[model samples]
Target: MWKSRKSLVELSGNLRLIVSHARYGKANFHGSNTHPHNRIYIVEKTKSPDKSYIANLSASPGQKVILRPGHVYFMPKDQTVEWNFTPGVTFVAFHFGLEIFRGIDLFDGDSEFIERPVSEDFTREARELMESSDDLGHAVRLHGMIYSLSGMFTDKTMKAVEQARELMREYAPIIHYIEEKCDAQTTVAELVDHFGMTRNSLSKGFAQTVGVPLKTFMTRCLLRKVTQQLLTTGLDSKQIAEELGFSSEYYFCRFFKKHTGMTPKAYRSDILH
Candidate 1:
């Protein structure tokens, strides 16, 4: 059953679209808050938040992440989600299997990057389009959104998925090694010595399996380490650089700018304020 339409739901018999308009009262929630609808959900946070507004949701037993206002989360259906929300948490949820693009990039995407910051106006428009009785229009809007989001992943950039778990396990020692040495000077030679793999093999194999070069991956780990310091601690750039084994503050700024396209000070200013 093939059809020429921008919307997957409009293709007729390919998929079914279900919309749920729900709200959560500000309360301390525990245990399973399960719903009967077993389909993918595109959740959008409408309305504005006052001070100290935060919500926590878990897709698994031990993993929890925050859900803030203006965050759009594309959640899979299989997750056992427990959510505790701030006062007046409204959700516009779309439920659908999205079977049309069975071979599309969603299957290869990582879950950690699910949430996106959408403008309030965009969320309102999507909510209105979804709430309207026009099914095709709603389907089209949802389809476009999914397409754009999934398009963010490519062969070179997609993160570790379930299928790559064995390889991830195999490289666990190397990842751990990188984690331990990310704050200091790390090189492929030292990594190869520790992991006992040749330079060429390690370089190409890690990139192919992990979707990024080992050097690049270690640099990212370092970036995360430094970024956390920049956010949480009151240490200045020079002190942080010295403690992290950088030769000088100038080199630290260069490294941060090379990786993130912004200096640490600028990033701290933009994020903290």
Candidate 2:
């Protein structure tokens, strides 16, 4: 189970954010070699020729390295390693618990490594935030910067998700308008005016981009609304059927069963349970 309270090292005093910056001199030291209580490490390289050993793998500056000022590495916890800092190598390290990185899957196994250079502007902002002596202020600023950096990474992964959602948004207004006017007898002809496309063109575009036929998508939207109403409200089957533009309660039950393999009452009970 995940802990609700963060450890002392994970909490920022008065800042509500935990961030630390350190510079290492030429040193080779090994103590407990056990993973510290903290689980995440954000190491930004200011100077290099540093060597890090984790498990059986070792990483150095020259090999498999692309140096940019804003370079960052995310190291997770429970891994043992030795650090050999080439004399006078300066860097900033942020130590936090694994919970902060819960949404990010940076590693593939029990232990993993990540090294990437950050943008110059981002690096400068992080450095300035770290320089603040005010713990609370520093935490807030650092939190924002780290979040921004994390968002940058997330945006890369979600590029396809965003594109799909954008297409959905473009057609959503028309779909919503049709749904609203369903009781008043809306037709596909009305959608042409809203989307400015012929029937074939619109169908093709929606299928190719949205990955669903127009009719099927509309059915999904209507069913989703019906499900929401069923789960949240005390309306009965017949009332919901009329509200959702179904001809009869029996028809609505069949439609719901076909799509979900369960009757409305059964679905609701499953959700509540």
Candidate 3:
């Protein structure tokens, strides 16, 4: 028998979970959209009776991950994955974001696809949790399952969390300000004034440290908010624009098209329909 005298490590950080969507059903999804959130699938049945199932254009160049039944797969954020799912593939999917620091996804810009096999009981438990009428219980169980799945990539997950903490410790205030201002129109000059730094200095430092130009980062933040609202809300473009503090729906549509290469209506039609 093995016994521990005490806990090996105590958790001190709180990871935030933002669940954008969840579903349990058969689906035939095939696309290459680079979404803002990470995704997980607890697959049940595939069209094939053999080992081959979903064809994945994996993160590694010239590599593939053939998703099989009774496995849970984790896909990172901001990476385009070409998926070719067989017809009548059934799974439970969760589209979510995990944040170790506010406004920073732990798996942001990661390209790896992680997978682990699960027992029938585990799959059944997930299905039950998804089908439950109790929202609070469902949320709790869903979080537990996500945490358990994340533990599969223990070293990588911990390293990412630690890196986020270190980065946030230095840039939290500016990041918070950007997040606050991103829902509306934001300007680099405004950031310079608020932070009491020259435009060049702020831009260089932010880009070097954050790996994205300051203005570009702000635009991405705004774009992610716009995309989330478009997917999760039934509001029209005008309503969404007003709610998001855009000056006009015309400008909003223009910005959306400029970044996403599609109008909001077209985006919804292609993605949600």
Arrange candidates, best lDDT first. Answer: 3, 1, 2
As a whole number from 0 to 100, the lDDT of residue 129 in candidate 3 is: 81
Question: Which parts of model 2 have CA positions greater than 4 angstroms off?
Answer: 1-156, 162-172, 175-189, 193-196
TM-score of every candidate relative to the true structure: 0.46, 0.39, 0.82
TM-score of 2: 0.39
Residue lDDT tens for model 3, 10-37: 2224567878777777756565555566
Alpha-carbon local distance difference test for all models: 0.54, 0.49, 0.75
Alpha-carbon error at 183 in model 1, in Å?
A: 2.7
Q: Clashes in each model (backbone N, CA, C under 3 Å)? A: 0, 3, 0
Candidate 2: 10-residue stretch with minimal lDDT? 99-108
TM-score ranking from best to worst? 3, 1, 2
Q: In candidate 2, residue 224 scores what lDDT? A: 52
Worst 10 residues of 3 by lDDT: 5-14
- Clash pairs detected, candidate 2: 15-136, 70-118, 71-117
**Candidate 1: where is the Cα deviation over 4 Å?**
1-160
Instruction: Return the TM-score for candidate 3, rounded to 2 decimals.
Output: 0.82
Candidate number achieving the greatest lDDT relative to the actual structure: 3
